[model samples]
Target: MSTAAKQKAKAAGIRLDDDSMDTPSEPLAPRTAPGQLIGLQGRVHSQQAEIEKLKRALEQRAPGKLPLEKLHEIPGRRRRLTSAEYAELKANLTAYPLAQPITVRERPDGEYDIVAGHNRAAVYRELGRTEIDGIVLDIDDSMVEYAAFFSNLLSPTLSDFEKFWGFKSLQESTGITKEELAKAAGISDSHVGRIMKFDLLPSESKDLLATCPERLGSNAAEQMAKAVAEGREDKVKAAIERLVSDNTFTQAQAVAATKADRAPRDRHEPMVIRRGARKVCQISARNGVVGVSFSGSAADEADQWAEKIRVFIEAELGKQ
Candidate 1:
């Protein structure tokens, strides 16, 4: 150890062995390169200043009022509040003014973007107020999805469709697949997949589910989506019509009934056409289309029998 270091250590109550240090060496002084020492001192001062700034920030109050005109709404993966929900919020706020501050981030355009408390800001606007209390945060643009999601997590009135759309928006905006988002959002992967299927549904079916989101749970929606995927377009539309017409049936029952009604019927043997001991032809009908096939011998006589076949069909229609 240098002589000055030894002295300093000794002054600081550090013990050293004198006999081991008996070898002659240049005396060690508390020497540091001038520039390096200045740099280190500057670093220490900078760190202490940062610590003080953090302490002051922690002690600061919530941000003051932000003008409604200067606030820009956040887009992507956020649920729109229902009219009833809006009314309820307005009523509550009317009874009692806002106690909690909303959250926002300053934009480069000199406007603030809302991070949370959309409904509150909306209510304030409805009340003819020009400004509302909020806190400014340093949220990254990439984190907006999670931030919007968690902000609405505690809401009790959000519908299944709304949540689905929110998750979908997150998936699209963040470039994450539904499976990855499912884990992050604390939803089942299968459920996420099912919700995403809503986008694939025909517009008519989508509107039905959107209008009555509470009626159709994820399972029923998935079932309907599966039916759509299987090319049961007419059946899905019919099912949606039935659901709209009859409010008595639950979504599950409606889905079940639709599935049962659309199930492929068992193949029935074609009706045999016989004249006495001779089998003439076979008749079959599927999806309202009728077909008649002639035996090898009768095939040559099909043209001759066409007039008779028309007459027979007319007779059958008359009977019906």
Candidate 2:
């Protein structure tokens, strides 16, 4: 067996010896190392042919003007321009009139499938424009999804909520894993996980975030999620209420306070010293050490009490 194969077997917790290689558990195919090179050459040529075909298609069909009614939106589009942005874009387009052409793919049903520029198209339609300039490309079904994903993902106006949902929608639409989505979305794997943490919030919390997404950020959302996970939903709700009412209230402080509330107490309870049914101080002791804690007027008189305790100890020792 080759060194690579041996390493693989070792990784699988299988021991392979020289004799084991001679008589394998399963019949192995004859090594076709040279044939693999030929197969690779054939694959290269096939890929080159495919690329050439696509190039020819692009060269033959240039961009043209298409009616707005003929264009159709993809199933999942993440970019949603705000009303103000839409109005601004419409005004700009009306002034400039066709600064850039939107991209679309000609479908078999005679309707053009918009790959990018859904927002631009909507703006044009809102302006009562009949036809808009578009670059019609011949793209495969797989590339269309990628086209939509990259198009909306690169938008400057994309919100964090939109981005979170974009990753989710693309993963569901394309059946891709989080790791794959992370790479395509140009973010770290944990970033994807963190964005997904928003979903853990209750509907009331989610609605609160939806109103002012910029109010509570991902870190706050994570803390809130942690609070929920620890069965501190009531505390989290109170924190949210405080957050909504008080602008000075911080999420970090809320998370810290919640965690402190849940912290395990010391095994032994402190003894309370009282005066006339009124609490004065608490004395805590462990092992060989005795601690006296004083409060109010008792604190001012602690020195005298200490001297008396020392004398008492001395007298007890003398008697013993």
Candidate 3:
């Protein structure tokens, strides 16, 4: 195997012997080296021992009813469900028994950190149930995060925004690169990059997304991020706000809103007071400011003209 492949296998807790062939073309010959045969036997024994140990650990932590009060929720471990979805889940649980037990890891503080099925536990609590069906996982703190991430990532109902946040949390916790994350998640590098654009959104927009992750998708988020980078942050925020508030608002329309043009302001044409062919004075108004320029000999009459304009304005105001 290549060095990179070996490294990846090692990370996943798989031992890759350098001399081992992944796909042997023919069966081992009777004249094969005795040392190689002995090595293979030793490896098989070691693997069997490990498997037995794992089975024992699993038996010790077998699924059972756990106290609801002792179960603790870990942030970023569970994906948020929409209100209607939560209601639906609760109704299903109420009508039938839990199909799958929740996965949890026992903490030193006598509490269990939820590894998966947060919504299930919550619904059980709301139904006034004292305990829930759960199984304890025999994983360390580092593996706990990986377990939670994979469980949530594989969920069909998980939104792209939620997936992005979960991937981000994993990256921050493990200091893993994007390529490594994509490999770990079994997704493409470009897909990871597109989902990560949600990070480029403004803080307020992110806050809104936290409440409704399904409101916007990764593709729309990419366009909005581009708009924000081009100094259209306020418009992007407005688009997200509208998207969250209005049920009929589409993601494409939200993206278009960032590029929407504002209403044009009223423009005034410049006025020039001239004497036949000789230009006397020119006046212009722009952005609430008025400017006047005198031409040639008209420059000498600037003060008189200013006094006359001030008197005319004062007389107009007095009439009002």
Model 2 Cα lDDT, one tens digit per residue, 17-74: 1123556476643369887666545544443344344435444556689999999987
Compose the digit string of candidate 1's lDDT tens values, residues 1-320. Answer: 43223222323341111123566894553366986566545644443343233324323646688999888776532345657777988898889867666667789998988877788887898899998888776644534444554455446666666567566554443345566667655668887787776666567666665555555566677788788777776777777767766778677776775563557775876799988888889898877777888887899998878878899989999998
TM-score of each: 0.47, 0.46, 0.54
Error of 3 at 249 (Å): 2.9
Number of clashes recorded per candidate: 0, 0, 0
List the lowest-lDDT window of 10 residues for candidate 1: 10-19
Please rank every candidate by lDDT, starting with the best: 3, 2, 1
TM-score of 2: 0.46
Error of 3 at 3 (Å): 40
> Quick one: RMSD of model 1?
20.3
Question: Each candidate's lDDT (Cα)?
Answer: 0.64, 0.65, 0.77
